[model samples]
Target: MVTEKNNKGNQISRRSFLTGTATAAAGFMIVPRHVLGGKGYTAPSDKLRVAGIGVGGKGESDIAEFAKGPADITVLCDVHDSRAANSVKRFPKAKFYKDYREMLDKEHKNIDAVSVSTPDHSHAIQAMAAMQLGKHVYVQKPLTHDIYEARMLTEAAKKYKVVTQMGNQGASGDGVRQLMEWYNAGLIGDVKEVYCWTNRPVWPQGIPWPTTPAPVPSDLDWDLWLGTAPKKDYVNKLVPFNWRGWWDYGTGALGDMGCHIVEPPFRVLDLGYPESAEASVGSVYVDEFKQGYFPDSCPPSSHCILNFKGKKGKPDVKLHWMDGGIQPARPEELGPNERMGDGGNGAIFIGTKGKMMCGTYGISPTLLPTTRNKEVNVKQTIARVPEGHYVQWVNAAIAGYGKKEVSSPFEIAGPLTETLLMGNLAIRSYDVRKPKANGNGFDYPGRYIKLLWDGPNMKITNFDDANQFVKRTYREGWKLGS
Candidate 1:
């Protein structure tokens, strides 16, 4: 995407921009300032004109945070007017549209960046479209609904040459940096095991889909809301929030919390793709005696183990992820009264020398034996993001791609997202059912199997059926393309 604009009133045509330019080849804006203007700017567009695609709830606050910096939210788009109301009211000068496609077509020339905070399903398409227009992008956590989309976005960021950041604010927090410093200092020596957990799925899960369809909200464009997911009737509680349980839209708990919780350990260890993944999920019963299959929704809880390759001579590392209220065993070093992971969500790193932990958003980092948090005075070797996640992206966009660094750019977030989603892939694979030849019962071959991964190729080497979850087919009308 285009980052820096030309000064001194240099002009370029749409054809020149859509095609290519020598500067674009070198990570500069192909479209000059004269070709894109509005909102009271001169030859050099000093202010970043950001257009929000999902300007509701989290989105409303996302754009609001952007506006706190040198950005003008030029357009607000949401499928539901009721949902977009707060943002619309907040930015009265910004134009409002229900369809992002129309907003982009009409407002592309005016927008310098895009912040996409839509559901997991639409994230790929909205962010892809914006990137294609040479606009910088700040996409929300988990990056995309599927591994394939995350991989695509990672490559697209480099291909488009835009400043990009995934919405994992914790990646910029001081707590994570402290953890990194401690690890680097060998306070946590040769970390071989990591545990991250969350109490998510505050929305329903491991349940059947709502059989009766609810009337679509009058102000909501239901079709647009569904985006890339297969056509389904609108149901109550799916809008505004509570879509986390369903596979067709949300990616369950792992996708929702993994990026925020896993980022700390991932960055500290400088980890990459997992070599293998496996899961043991909480099962739901049909009544009291029989276990039933509900592939439509995610399991209520799960424990996933993702094995990663260690450095040349070191032993492998195992990262454990637990959600739906499941947590790892408390460290023996801590007293019984001490809270584990801020009571519900937290991460723990176990190394050869010592252990360390942190709460959600990587906040309140602590060393085990609790008192050591103060006794061990590790120097702050890593730089902290004073501007935080949102402003960091804005400044980077202003500085242009490759000029400034972002904490969770697609290059980093893509593999991180894929790693977390591998757990979900195992969970989904665990539910795949096949009938027995005798026709007496069914066999779930996917269960109790370790999925070997070829991360570079984005495939499940051991389970072909499980590979289906790696990518998804969009609904007829939507497309995630260049």
Candidate 2:
């Protein structure tokens, strides 16, 4: 019953509240004067001096990358025994820790940077601590589990004067850079609406209610896995990867893939935040076995529609997100014969003049215009979309590369993440309201609710009740900046 509406009945309006203080906000720290020019200075280049937390699964890849060539990996941490073992094998000299705080404290002087590849919920706490210690950070996406945390991390990166990078590696891709060029150059004209869709059931779609007590793996540290989250008995249903679909630990398909799929549009358009968000989910199978996957929770298998209106930019732009293994109907722009892959987990920007198409990862993006419509030839973007994911980050970390700056810095990324997270809220509200998965609950299939964001206050004016979920209460020791 509780929604965004305030007790005073004042509604929130979505507006541009950022100070355009991107550079000032980040306070980009250059190599110190002594390190840069003084004769007595010694560079900390014996290796970049790296440490990693959550070193398993995706975290393993992060560790390996930081350990390549000229880096001294002095610290490795993971709650899981097997994952930590494999990482230790790769960098035998590195000290290992089950608690990241201990590793950071003991190895503080030896480490210059840290890579965070933890679950969605824990990103803010770990990243903030590293930044507070004057360490540069590289973290995985969706940057934080909620809008409030994303903003906090961005601000902390600024206040601490540390270089920060989110782990949406596709934002570093050449294809996405070129796609942004095309969109910005008006090759697609003034784009008003974009459809970012994907087919991502690989983590097991359509759950039919999980049963109790499958043996917990010895390798997994169940207590730590539930770090900062509510405690519950360990169950087999949420392990390996399927935790994503449930509301307790994950954000369903959109939360899982939006960072990758939405990167191109967010950067090219300079999107701030959305005016409204709503959803129509497929089905929610309830069971006692499933509790606490997605915090502030929502049902699984949903189609959500998010609408963005301009408070300072152009006009309103609508983004339709289809997942839970669903694909968008083929765009009319494509010839009837020319078809795309069925796993339609990509974005289509329907601009005023033409349309731009991009794959899920965004690098292998392409341009497609209707044969009947006028065609415009524009200069290709020279950002040089990378050939692969790891290479881009590795090159950046090595050469300290590029003149233009990384594509998805928290400035551009933070807003995009805010928009994507709205889908999570929509799902939660839908479950509370008990809306039909199809359009049956309201007059329309997707109902829209306007929200106003006060960037300075970090409050949502229109939705007072929803603001409670905007920032979650972190468990005692796991609090951010502690």
Candidate 3:
């Protein structure tokens, strides 16, 4: 993500040489992985020292995969001891801490890279803190909670000159490469529209916020787990998971599955920022014959349409996102017996000449009418990620910033995340309520209105209230930036 300029004579700046006499003399705190006394592999001392934050659930598996690469899992940090139990048991010798701030403050020198698999809310702050310390960072997908956080982290990666990879593993898969190859070969022609759908919120959503106070678990630090989110009473079933429904914490289904499903067309078409966004969200029933407007939680289902600006004589593309079990219409070319987009979650590209579809992680891609898949042969133009996503980051970190290429680097991921989050902004704005002058129920001006966006300015030009979702104010004691 970040590149260092070379010197005119040596072609080696402080970072380029990895670990030469000049690099050592420059006093760089973190050391890149360098081969030692081995022709094929690196010694233990030369392995990348990685510290993992949120070492639970996805975080647990993330570090485990990194360890399979050229990495040594040296430290594990988690707000909940119960969730991190498996990681701790596996990495018995690795240091453990409850606070990421304390871990980075005390052990930044000991670790060369940091892996963040925390909730969406805390991603920007934690990753930013690591990059500022000159640590190569691998952060989980939907990169950050808000659009501004995504933008900030993208800029910081370049400014800090650190290698960075987002956790959209599908971006590194052979499936996406295959899709790119077919599109590049004119098998899909020029895609004018795209559809990505998911059956998410397999957690609760479209409901009233829980008010009943729940006892905080003894093994968890409640305050630490609520990092960057607005503080309140601990609710039932809020921790470990299910927090994806809350606006104060999660980005709902878009943040949950967008990175995987959207990355295929995004890479295939080389998409940039969108020019506008609009959404239609499904409502919940608070009582018989009455619709509920729960701004605190995400809707049960939503369909968002984002219009991207065309370039170089190409027509503007409309990217559609559906979630909470909502899906686009099945293509007529396919038979009734054939499956549509892996049944529950998948994406479809509607092009001028033909259509193609893929399932989650961009797997099982095929052309329309099923039988055409065998007729069209696209050469493998892009190299495959043999080591997979997690290990790709490990290898890239070991090779130093801008040395080895990585899939879903911040340069590509930032705009993708902002594009997805734009849908969220539209959904949130749909609930923007104003009291009627007659003191009646309310008037919702934001509902059913297209939000013109200025991507460079990071604003919703037509709607002022919608801009609030672009950036959220952090709670006290938490800050993110240089």
Candidates' lDDT values, in order?
Answer: 0.82, 0.64, 0.82
Name the runs in model 2 displaced over 4 angstroms.
Answer: 1-44, 204-211, 284-298, 311-313, 370-377, 385-404, 430-460
Per-residue accuracy of model 2 over 176-279 as CA lDDT, tens digit each: 66675566565776778888877764575445335476778877878787777776677675665677755556666777788998777776565666666667
**RMSD of model 1, in Å?**
7.6
Residue-level error in angstroms, candidate 3, position 198: 0.8
Clashes of 2: 18
Please give the distance, in angstroms, between residue 230's alpha carbon in candidate 1 and its true position after superposition. 0.7
Q: Which residue pairs overlap in candidate 1's backbone?
A: 1-160
lDDT tens digits, residues 75-189, model 1?
A: 9999888888889999999998888899989998888899999999889999989988888999998799999999999999988888889999998788987787777677867
Pairs with steric clashes in candidate 3 = none
Q: Residue-wise lDDT of candidate 3 within 1-482, one digit each (tens)?
A: 22222212222211121221122325545532352322112222368889999999999999999999989999999999999999999999999999999999999868888999999999999999998888889999889999999999999888877778899988887787778767767776788999999998799988888768899999989999888888898988888788999899999999899999998878777678899989988887756756766778888899999998765566789999999889888899979889988889999999998999999989999899789988887655556778888887887766566566677778888888999999898888843466544432234456589989999999999989889899999899788954
Task: Report lDDT (Cα) of residue 156, candidate 2.
Answer: 80
